[model samples]
Target: MGLVVPFEDKNPDKGASIESLVSLVSADMERVNAMILSRTGSDVTMIPEVANHLISSGGKRLRPMLTLAMANLAGYHGDGHVKLAASVEFMHTATLLHDDVVDESDMRRGRIAARIRWGNQASVLVGDFLLGQAFKMMVEVGSLRALDILSSAAAVIAEGEVMQLAAAKNTETNEDEYLAVIRGKTAELFAAACEVGPVIAGRPKAEQAACRSYGMNLGIAFQLIDDALDYGGTSANLGKNVGDDFREGKITLPVVLSFRRGNDDERAFWRRALEENEASDSDLETAIAIMHRHRALEHTIERARHYGAIARDALELFPKSAIKDAMLETVDFCIARAH
Candidate 1:
């Protein structure tokens, strides 16, 4: 049931460069881009305008690429992958729009957030529109299995958002609780995106499971690196202002670890800074210092590497080829984002 990928070389720290992955799926991605543009259009005009605002903005489009690449890796030659890829992107975009509104965020991808540009109402409505469009495309694909996977993911993502809301500014949120939220909010979609490729490709259950496993673990690593980077990264690294998480009082692994290890005075600082939302400019600096003293950020990255390794290993079912190598390298790249 396993397929062979084009494996040329190996540099575990770095392999299968992103450029190569993009190149491998370039033609299919072009069709996906067209689908995205066409489906976003509407007579209301604002629909397309607001949709394009984020769609046209420079995003790596990594999620869709994963769908397309996984399909290729499974030896799929159908046009359905293009539609599925677009659906994945739309789902991801919808979440971003909703997330910014929920987080009361001002910026996304280095510009003022859509919520700010058009207001929260527009952002939310457009996000809903995108979700509707995503489901429509999934139906058009006519893969009941794929639809079930992605449709369920939408619900899980919503649940994850609510779980995060409940955990927000609550220092008692443990590591397991935080992991559950991310697995739902982030990893669910990744797993679905990768799983559907093999489902449509008619690969065996084992292969489909492998792809799902790869995506789920890769997504966790990606988010973990992001969590660490929020406290320790620069604007360039984060693609948005640093300290946004701290400023918003979002509970992430670094905060959880630091809180668990801190002394009473430090615990009080977390309570005031996070629970009370009293984080001053200097507080972010102090927070980083505490995280460093507690080895929080470093440990977060270490956790990411652990997941990245599992992601890499998930693909061991597939024979070595360039695509498999690239997929494996993506895990390394996700962890490397911390640097």
Candidate 2:
């Protein structure tokens, strides 16, 4: 749910054409950036220092861009989109800070994580600050419906985090449980961020529901790709060390499938490595090899492609435009990253 800098590959067919979305929302993005900078400032020096560390890092701000793009796709021409976009970014950034702490991560966006730079205490407090600011911006927009959606999402995300914490290190966690965790932790905000765009745009209920569906499915696809990438991707691709999920004992779909399908010896290996929290780098290599043996990563990506297709189909009602095409390309990019 952190800034997933989607496939940056130069090939037109493989990349997400993120530049298209950027160009379409360029001016508005600048305003959102300014809003971010202004809102992140504080009289307390440590607050801005910790907040800006991750904010200033090269996060693509994809979630906020989704907000802006959805608004545009809805034919919106109001100033509300800018504030809402900024608010969505704040919510995402806050989650990243908190997620790193919970995951005990050392890197983010190819740099030292905020929790590593500042203490976990500072990172968490700053994350709370960002959430407060995000809500403030949402309130300023004056749309009760939008506020309701986002506020509910914030709670759902918290619930997702708790669910994940409970499921951590448990190899018995099923695919359904994993899906629920990701849907709450990751997709809830994506749905909220996209849905609010149409809500503020005064689009119809059908359009709002479609955008929410698109965002939810896309978010699921995004997380699935990320889970696959953790085992197979390079540092350049994920901006974090490979095997982080394994190291953290995260029960991703890949791990769930592998554990369920593995031989007794392989299951023991998973227990010793993941459940026991004793995996070394060499063990990570071995784990990935076993996942390949079981085609865990391959099947996980297939699942991602399924969700991506659903995401693409969710946009069928929208008239074709640059924004819609870019959004569609985003689905392709999400699946392509696994390749």
Candidate 3:
């Protein structure tokens, strides 16, 4: 019998979206967007061309918006949040460029990846440039604490990338190892993005930690849902080709669970397809079938909800407010995407 996972109807609305958070931070995001466009300019033409191609792509800009909203929640009064938000965005974009190259991916944000449009050499170089610019913005902010948090996050994210590279194509990867990878790569940045807001706003350390907790948990939930979506979501909803992770031999949480629970024949199939990268054209369908047989996708989403609940509670440190509510709703929005 297949695993029967019961999903809670925690978020009954089902229409939860990032619109609340977007509207809450609209004015500041405009400034962040302006700074992003201005900083992308360079004497070298290709630099701007390549950077703009991805930057202009329709990303939700959720990280920077989180920075802005957190700053506002902390009752910030100046332009430093804008700079920090832009810096956060640059760091994220740089990672995307580098990741596409590392993953040898063709599509990103519904368009050809920068690595494919430009050469790998150009893509890597431009990613370095963006990192340089991101650091420059952090320095301009002149907050040693904020700088330390973001810079440390950068290092952690790099480590996470390396960890992921090591785990790639290894079907034996366990859930704990996978969690460590995403916490380093994805959750650290989210934590930094929100924590910096309170740091710059001169909020209490407790508040800063709370924001970090919220971001960290939310980031994990977000990535978990993405992992589940890899096999279940459409190309349009995923913003990349469906089954991209499968094709890349990425051992995400769904694959991890399915591998552990599957029978001997299923285990051999996983080794052949993921460990050896010998997946045929119909193999993606077969993989999805195995995932369904084990209820891997449902279980992954349940794990996401587990983290999402923590994220929602993390914000309990703050009083009720529009921004807080929006942030809480954003967590629901992240998890609801799977449906």
Candidate 4:
């Protein structure tokens, strides 16, 4: 997770409302720094450095922004949104820390990751510290509803990590299984981000539910498109060298689609590459060729569009406002990556 928003459309105007709302989210991040720093104190030089390293690194911070924007759209004017939003960011950062250790990723946002820079031990403990901090912040917010939202999201995220481990190899990772993992790993956080805002704002239950659904769909679409890009997009456009999934013997959207469309021999090639952990250049070329032949990229794009639309529809329950417009822009940004 480099701060680079590879999935966003080149069009600046796509999700103007969400972007505008995100401006406030950015300001709130500063507040987050103050909160974290005061808690860490002078003894923790490495804590501050690692925290800054991860926070300052380029990131979309999309989840926290959703928190702020939904709060605004739902007519919540309190300052607590800032604290809650920061808590959301902290939770996300903790996840990134854990994900890196699990994935063994060396780079994020084109820089050596925290785990890489400070060592895995530092990364793991710091991640735990942040998770504890995030909960503390949530408790300060004093909203059981907010706690419920984040706690549920955390549980779902853990389920996703385990699900990925279980589903890592073998061709059984169908669209449904893929969707389930996406929901658990990515969409749950997105939903948590948006839901916290409305819950804190004391919004109507229906509206809050819609925003959660909207974020979930948006997250799903975003992750699916990312999986597609791993097979097709350039490293410059997609960021973080592609093919890590294939290297790790993980099956993603394009691979699944390609195998579905491949002939017996072609399918056998995938079986050997994925199941046996052996893939040659010819195998890579064949997989790429197969994805292209069956238009898997296009298929993935269409799926992303479907989710973007659902995200937009989630905003329909809200009255027209600058915030709503920004939310819509974010939806477009999510789908326009491939467009």
Q: Estimate each model's TM-score.
A: 0.95, 0.95, 0.96, 0.90
lDDT of 2: 0.88
lDDT (0 to 1) per candidate: 0.89, 0.88, 0.92, 0.77
Q: 77, model 2: CA deviation in Å? A: 1.8
Candidate 1, residues 233-297, lDDT tens digits: the string is 77665767788999999999999999999999999999999999998988888888898888898
The local lDDT score (0 to 100) that residue 39 gets in candidate 3 is 96
Residue-wise lDDT of candidate 2 within 107-137, one digit each (tens)?
A: 9999999999898999999999999999999
Q: Where does model 4 exceed 4 Å of error? A: 1-18, 24-30, 33-42, 280-283
**If candidate 3 were superposed on the true structure by all CA atoms, what would the RMSD be?**
3.1
Candidate 4, residues 1-339, lDDT tens digits: the string is 121223323334242334565665566667655775565443678887887788777777777778877787788877777777777888888888888888787766657788988989888888888878888878988899899889888889989988987888777578888788889988899998888888888888998899898889989988887787767665555546666677677777777788788788888888898888888645665666777778776677777878888888988988888778777878777766553
- Best-first order by lDDT: 3, 1, 2, 4
Q: Candidate 4 clash total?
A: 10
Could you tell which candidate, 1 or 4, scores higher by TM-score? Answer: 1
Question: After aligning candidate 3 to the native by TM-score, how far in Å is the CA of 321 from where it should be?
Answer: 0.4
Q: How much RMSD separates candidate 1 from the native structure?
A: 6.4
Worst 10 residues of 3 by lDDT: 1-10
The TM-score that candidate 2 achieves is 0.95
Q: How does candidate 4 fare on TM-score?
A: 0.90
Per-model clash counts, in order, read 5, 0, 0, 10
Comparing 2 with 4 on TM-score, the higher-scoring candidate is: 2
lDDT of 1: 0.89
User: What tens-digit string does per-residue lDDT give for candidate 3 at 41-111?
Assistant: 99999999999999999999999999999999899999999999999999999999999999999999999
Q: Highest lDDT, which number?
A: 3
